[model samples]
Each structure stands twice: as C-alpha cells, then as structure tokens.
Target: MMLYKLRLTFVLIAIGLNIGVQAQDFIPILKKRAYLNNSYQKLLKVTDTLKIAFIGGSITETNKGWRDQTMQWFASKYPNAKFKQINAGLSGTGSSLGVYRIDEHVLNHQPDLVFIEFAVNDYKASKHHILEAFEGMVLKIKKANPKTDICFIYTFSEAMLESYEKGFYPNSIIAMEEIASHYNISSVNFAPDIIQRIKNKTLAVIGPKQHPDSTYFSSDGVHPYENTGHLYYTQTLTKALDKLLNKGKRFNSKKDIYYSAQLEKAKMTHLETQMFNGIKAEIPPPKFSSLIQNIFALNQVEDLLQIQFKGDRIGFMDIIGPSSGTLKIKIDDQEPQYITRFDRFCSYERLHWFIIDGLAPDIQHSISISLAPNRIDKARILGKATDTEDYKKETWRVGKILMVDK
Candidate 1:
C-alpha cells in the first residue's frame, strides 16, 4: 500500500515537471539583464499605498484579465500594502494614440508602476512611429516621477507565432526592446514560451470545433477568449514577477535623456475647435464594436466639425466601420487630402490618426475636416460580408482631436 501511494506521487510530480519544461522550453527569460527591481523594492517597502497602471490594447483591457490577475497577486503577496490599480487600456489602440493621451488617461493619476502592452497592436505602425511613441511614454512617466518604474510586456497572437518558431523576434518587439535597452529597463516576452507549447502540440492556436461551440486560445486569432488566453498571459506575467522579486538587484540608470520634438510639443498642446460649419449635428456612435471608453458619435454628412488650433502636429481619431466614408482634410493652405476609412477588411471601429508633422514648431496652424461627397460607392472592397442591417450607410465619426505644439 505504501509503495502504491509513493508511485502515484512520483507520477504526478513527473507530469508537472514535463509540463513546465514544455512551457518554458523556448521562452526568453527577459529581454535584458535589468529587471523591475525599482518597482519590486517599492512593493516590498510600501508605507502608504502603491498605485499601478496598465496601458495596453484589448488583452489588458479585459475586466478580469491578466491586469486584474496581477493585481490580485499583489494583494495576496502584500496584505498590508494598499494598492490602487488603474486600467488605462483601450481596445484597438496602439502606442501612437497612447503617447498622445497618456497625460489625460494615465499620468494624471500618478502611477508608481506602469505596464505597457502594444506588441500585438503596433505591428501595423512604422518602426519610427513605434519608437517615438514608446520612448515618449517612458520619458513622460519617468520625468513626471523619477521614482516611477515601467516595464514592457509583449503579448502574442496567432499571427506572431510563426516568427517566434523561426527564432526571430517580431518587429514590434524589436522596436520596443531598443527603447527598453536605452532606458535601462526590462521587458517580458512570451513568444518563445508559447511557441514551445505549440511545437509540443499541447496547445492549439485555434479551437478545432466551431459553429455550436469551440475551445480556443483566441476566437479570431487576435483577441484571446476571456478565459484561456488570459490565463496563459497571467501565468506568464506572475512567473516573471516572482523571478524579479527573487533576483534582488537594482536597475542601473544612466540618466540618459530620451527626447522627441513631437513629444515635447504634445505636452502643452490642446485640440480646440476654432471654427465649425455652424450646424449642430448629433453623430451616432460607430457600429464597430470596441471596449474603449469615450467615443463621440457622428451620423450626418451635412454636420461638419471644424476646428482650428495652434500646433505643429494635428490629428483626430475616427471609426472605420463597414459603412464608413471619406474625409477631406486640409491643413493650413495645403492641398486637401482625401482619406477613405472603408476597406474590405473593415469590421471593427479602428482608431485612425491623420496628422501633418514637421511644421513650424511654434507657429499657429489651422486645419479643416469635412465628409467628402459621393464617397460611399468609391470605397474599395477588400472582403465579402452578409448582413440584413444597412452597415454600409453609417457616417464617419471622430472621437477627439490630438494636437502638439512647441
């Protein structure tokens, strides 16, 4: 009887070891030698309260997602410490918008620790833009509170696994790592770990069964399901945190200055309305689904929202739904540029940025935007869809204007 019990225990231990080995086989422990020791020290010796903020896309935006899980872990680990967790995550937004709104959405609350996640969403942006936005966020946070600690976390989707399998880092991750290296900060990457599991055939990118019901890490290869994908992300983050705590090393700050002209201008710029077409039009919210808060609705073409502001860079965010239209944008005597928001791949309310950069930093600039006439039929078709609802007739809507001045 005793032998039988020992045998069962050994089997369980073996199974656990095998699973761990497979899960960690290809995972890169950390992007650099530096870890979040600054934040760890703060956590270990908190007198009053520690406020943490997470900035990311939909994955980190889920209510009980990894962000919440990490918060719970903190609560459990430090029972006496008061913790205030702020979720500044907006779905379908990359770091470009993040840099523009960090002051309003995150920095105002004054967070001691900030976790940034845009690996999945920033893929489409140019490397220069990604670097500028990422560096801007880090610099702004650290400048506001020198003691604040920031960490970059890379989240994966079905599209990114192939690159990891080939032992190459994705472009987004590479761009962020450059900033992380320059800032002497640390980054957590899960691509190798996930690829290991996929290679071992223990996990499927997409669930086999469909229609009635299905089991998958992600429903559509991008956003993870509420349970499975989020759990994996939480597990990865917690493990990294545990290691960071145990390392007992402090970050080496070189006191390097990271600066961008656009970022500096953005610090004191506002996008106020200088003029309108003198019409009050109630814009309906874009039909594209999203988890982001504060979306302005526009439903009429005749309703023109004209604004004039003094800034070097000026832009606005709008939805590109199935029935999305085009906008005629003119910046300070420049030729009017027509921007079409519709495409065959249009499904979600994507956040789009239209800005003219490199203008006289301190000069006052005026811009105008209005819906282009006869735009519905001219939209390029990229895919096929079926719907009883007239999703093709919805008007374009802008959320808010972003401006940056010297």
Candidate 2:
C-alpha cells in the first residue's frame, strides 16, 4: 500500500508537470539559483517581541491587512511582549509591485520580522518574472537589513482544487518551502492548511461542495473573509518569530537599493498580469465604440449622452471602464455644452473614456482634451513591438501609444 501510494504521488506530480509549465509566481518550476523572496535563507538572528510586517495582495488585505490577528496572537501568548505590526497590503496588487515598495512599506521601517503573501494573486504577476520580483524584494531586505527575519506565506485561490486537478496553493508552497529550506528562514503553507484540514475532516470544507462559503479561517471565495484566517497564519508566524529572536546575528549595511521605476510598474496589477507571459484572460473593455475619442475618468461625473453635438455632428464613444467620463463642445465661455456618461458601467463596462470625432474637421475650431480621448485618430502602432532578440514571441512588450500629429 505504501508503494502504491508513492506511485500515485508520482503520477500526480507528472500530471501537474505536463501542463507545459510556465514559470509561476505562486509556483516556481524553474530551478533558478535562488528564489525571489528568500526571506529565510540569509540566516539572521534577533530577540524578544520583534516588529512584524505583512505585505501582499487581496489575500493579505482581506482582514484589514492581517495586522489585528498577528498582533492578537502575540498579545495572547507574550502578554508583555514588545512587537510592532505594519500591514502594507493593497487588494488586487501582485507580488511584482509589493516587492517594489518593500523598502518603503517594509525594510525601511527596519522591523525584526516580515510576513509576505503574494502567492494567490499570481494570476496578476509576470509569468516567469515573478521570481525575480519576489527574489529582488527578499534579497534586498536580507542584504540591506539582515537582522530582519522573513516568512514567505503562500495563499490560494478557493476555486482552484475544484477545477479538474489543479490546486493553486500546493505547488507554490512547494516552491517556497524549497527556498525556506535553502535560506533556513521559517515559512507557512497557509492555504494548504485549510485544504488538508478539510481532507482530514479536521476543518470543515468552506463555501460550497469543493469551496467553502465560510471557513473557520475564510470567508467569501478568494480572500479570507474573516478574522480567523489571519489568526490561523499568525500562529505560524509567532512560532517562527520566537526562534529568530532567540538567535543573535546582524547583517552589515550595504545600502543595496534593489528597486527601480520598472519595479514601480509591479504595483499595478494590470501590468503584472500582462507580464504573466501566458494566454492570460484578455481584459476586454466595453464593446461600445466610436470613431473618435474616449475618456474614462469622470470623478463625480454621471450619466447623459457620452457624445452629442448641437452645432456639429453626433456619434458614440467607446465606454472602456467605470469612471467620470464626459464630452464637452464649445459654445461660448461659460455655456459650452457638456454631456456626462454617468454610472452606466455598473451594468455595462463603465465607459469613462470617449471617442469624439468632431467630423467638423475644426481641428482648429478646436477641441480640448480633458482626458486623452478613447481616440484612434491620435493612436498608432509605433512598430512591430514584439521581441526579435529570440524566436519566442514576447507578449509583455506593449505597442507604443503615440499621438499622431494631424
């Protein structure tokens, strides 16, 4: 039976690997020299009630950033222990960006501890590049401030296991575990704990049959919709912290500034998802299109004809996504006619941007842009923007959005 189980495990691993494995942030298949966030590897030591900072995406942001739970866990045990909690989590953010702001949100504060979680949202991270981003953040933290101990927590997508045979958090935990062992930093497989708990009947399944609607540790579908989920991980962190503080060591100050403007792009989930280098879900904007300009932000702006002209022509503009999108035509100084495309995308894709073709050719009579119009007239393909360096087509490189001078 043991041999049979081993054979079954081998089959499972083989099935998982056959998916033409792309480098994943949540799951590192690539045998690179080291992991992006090697918090445990640097081998640091510290003492009592260390300040702990947790950073990541929605999973991290779920319960007001998991700060409360982490603190509560310590408060219960240490009672008189000294500790600081900083939650630098923003929902919808990917690891690429979290790694960018580590200096600001994490390292600079010089906490003795940090809890990083960017695994679940790997959907929004750069395909093969997540490791570098994660690696960069951890290496930066360790190299500049080695005294700080790190915990790389892998989160999960609730619906993951239900789909065929793909389980999101397990492989990611595997990859992170590999890093933790190499660096000798403490780690936690947060998501899998709940999953395995349910398997063993120790923890009831959450949400639905495959997914739990509510967990002793989670709520909703993706983010842990409760305080308990945070508490769950906090226990693991507390144990890890005790060991690090007990050890006594410090890293020399190298002032290794490891991030850049490019890294800043990581903060934006859209950019990171594009970097996934996979057949990612195309974020299709609203179908509503016009032959002219489109504006996406209305800022308190609301519903009306997105595009209508009295002294000129009439047409519609593409309503991309929700925001305060409006169109204005000049009549005089105080009386220029204005149309606001209000909260429409609540049902449709909130059209904040518009395509306005004066059709009057009054390019001089003239048009002023509040927001760059959802304009094709101004947009042109800069070049064959794909990478020519290698045979493989690189999807990340964007087609430049250049303004065409009429």
Candidate 3:
C-alpha cells in the first residue's frame, strides 16, 4: 500500500509538471481587450448567423493558412453557431489599398468580427500613410456597424525579425497600435512569440535549404509554410481567442446590469442615456481630417474612365490579373505617361495602386485613363521567358479613384 501511494504521488507530480510546460507554450497573444461585448453577445447568445471577416495581404489570403485554420477551429468550438466567413485578403496589397476596397468586399457583408493583418506588407510604407489608412479602415467599419469587433493581426517577415529580436515591434505595427489604442480595438502580435521560438532553436526562420535539421517557419521568411508556420499562427490565434472568450463571459454576466444601473441613474437626473444605453448614433463622418477629400469607387473599368476634379494629389486603384494591361494616363495636358497594371505579381490577381502628387491644387484638373495599345515586353517585365501568354488578353479592371485636395 505504501509503494502504491508513492507511485500515485509520483504520477500526479509528473502530470502537473507536464501541464505547466504545456501552459507555458501558450504565450499571451492578446494585446488589448477593448469593447468586444457586441461580438460576444452575438456569438454566444444570439442564434442568428455570425459573420467573421479577415482582410490582409498574402498571409491572410493563402489557402490552408492561419485564416482557414482559425475558421475551422471556430466552427469546431462553437458547434451550434452558424458562421459566415468573409475572406477579403488580397496578396501584395497594403492598407493603402485596403482602405479603398473594404466597403465593397468586407463592410457590405456586415461582419460581426474582423481580423486585419497588414504589418508585413505595410513595412515599407510611410508612417503617416499607415496611420491614415489603418484608421480609415477602423472608422469605416465602425460607421458601417458600431457593434462590429475589429482586431489587428501582425504577422512576421524576414526584415521584421531584427526588430522583434530587439524586443520592439516594427514601425508599421507601432503606428497601427496607435489607432488600435485610440479606437479601443484588440491586436494580436505573433512576432514576439515567433522570435522567441527562433531564438530557442525550436522554430527555424528559413526552410531546410538553409537549416536542414531545424523545423522551418517559411521558405521566403514572409509567407509561413501552410503546415508548420501556419499551425503556429493558428495556435496563437486560438489561444488568444480562448482568453478573449473567457473575458467575454465575465463581461456578458455584468454588462446588462451595469448598463441598466447607469440608465436608471441617468433617468433620475433627467439626463440622456443614449450614449450609455448603447444606442448607436448616425454613422460618423470619415475621420480623415487631412488633405484626402474622398475615395470614389469607379468599379470595373474596361476601356476608359475620364474625370475632372480639383486636387493636388491623385491616384487610382485596380486589379492586377494575368490579363491586366497597362494604363495611359494624361493629366491636365501633361505628357501622357504609361503605367503597367501588369507586374511580376500579376501572375495572380491582386490589388495595386499608383499615386502622382505635387500637382497644383488650385486649378481644376482633368485626367483620362485609357487602355494602352502597345504590347508589353512580358519577358522584360516578369524577368522570365515562360508563361507570358496571359498578357495577350489585355484586360483592364480599375477599382477606385483616389483624389486629395490641398
């Protein structure tokens, strides 16, 4: 009996130690907990369909990656809930273009929760642009539906590894965090945990070609391999979700009571409780108080789109597909310049934008964008001699026109 008791105690100790090590592996991924009450209520209590949207660059767009994995996990976790997943991810595009396209692709769906990842793509962008575009997206979503929950997701890249190793987020992520803080949104940063794993020699930043014996994260150090790196990302996300959901439970229990008490207190003083009562007001105007006048959606443009406007800066957004051709833009009598909609990235369809600034804002300017007739040198543009047949179709699809007045 004494030997059996000692054996049982040893087994219990072993189990406890193993559990502790497992718990340590789940590093905290949640950066903030702002207001997810509406999402919580809708996801847990409401029987109506739950809509979750993900918008980002290639990382979120790739198949069988973190995005899809998390969706599957959500379905499994909430077996009774009907989920509508909206994937608005476009490869090689940053928040600059995302802000312009969100309405047509994501907001129209009226998603209850949105996951936005752009850190890697926006790495090279100016801080000012990142701030304006990311905030614009946040404001647009809230304007469309105040109850919508927005979460910023930061993925990794080779260039970002150094910053993460130095215990700092990349500049783009820091700028985005400012917006998240102001708007009370949550963010999940995978960099810290990923860097730690790399440092521990457990997660390889590059594939076997670079590190044969190590478990690799990605081939290019940007896009995670579907199985290995994506699995880590998915695990981080689900762990964060678990923590958020637990907090939501506590919030759900007391939120109604807390709000009711505030309402009663407001009524006693004859004060308006609309703000406290969660009655959403009219959608607020665009928060961009800067030079950006407005973004006008031109939709699909096959041949030509000519417009007149007064603006110091001008740009346009379009889809770059296999068949996408170049655009000839003539602005206010200037020499017509040719901009190719097809690039090395055009092998697959993705969003691309071009901007021309430093023009005089005083005078009314006219801009005509028409399909270029000249045949492009695909071999020169793509840096390859094969698979240039797609350029033959000469397709042009313009999505939006961006105008900024001084």
* The best candidate in terms of TM-score: 1
Task: Write model 2 residue lDDT over 293-361, tens digit each, in one string.
Answer: 222222221211121122222222233322323445442233455544433222223222222333443
Clash count for each candidate, listed in order shown: 6, 40, 0
What lDDT does model 1 reach?
0.66
**Candidate 3 local lDDT, 1-406, one digit each (tens):** 0010111010112321111111212313465446466666676764788789999998998889999999999889988888898988877889877776687678878998999999999998887778877867776676677667788998988887765544445788768877776666777877655766786798888875355578889998999987778888888778777656533412112121211111111000011112112222122123311112322221223345666767566676655667776677889889999987777766666556777767786888887777778767766777766355666667565435655422
RMSD of 1: 8.7
How far is 155's C-alpha from truth in model 3 (Å)?
Answer: 0.5
What's the distance in Å from true for residue 317, model 1? 2.4
Q: How many backbone clashes are present in model 3?
A: 0
| Candidate 3 displacement at residue 23 in angstroms | 24
Q: What TM-score does model 2 achieve against the real structure?
A: 0.49
Q: Can you write out model 1's per-residue Cα lDDT over 1-406, one digit (the tens) per residue? A: 0011111010112321122211222224454446565566667676867889999988888798889988998899888778999888877789988887787778889887899999999876777888888988887787677777788999888777655554455678768877887777767765545555666666667773343443467767777655667777777777767666543444544455554535633542323333455543333354333323344444566656666566557777665666677777777898888877776656655556555677665767676677777645523364454352545565665666666643
TM per candidate: 0.80, 0.49, 0.72
Q: Which of candidates 1 and 2 is the stronger one according to lDDT?
A: 1
lDDT of 3: 0.66
Ten-residue region with minimum lDDT total, candidate 1: 1-10
Stretches of model 1 off by over 4 angstroms after superposition: 1-27, 32-38, 45-47, 208-215, 246-254, 258-261, 264-274, 279-302, 319-323, 343-352, 358-362, 377-394
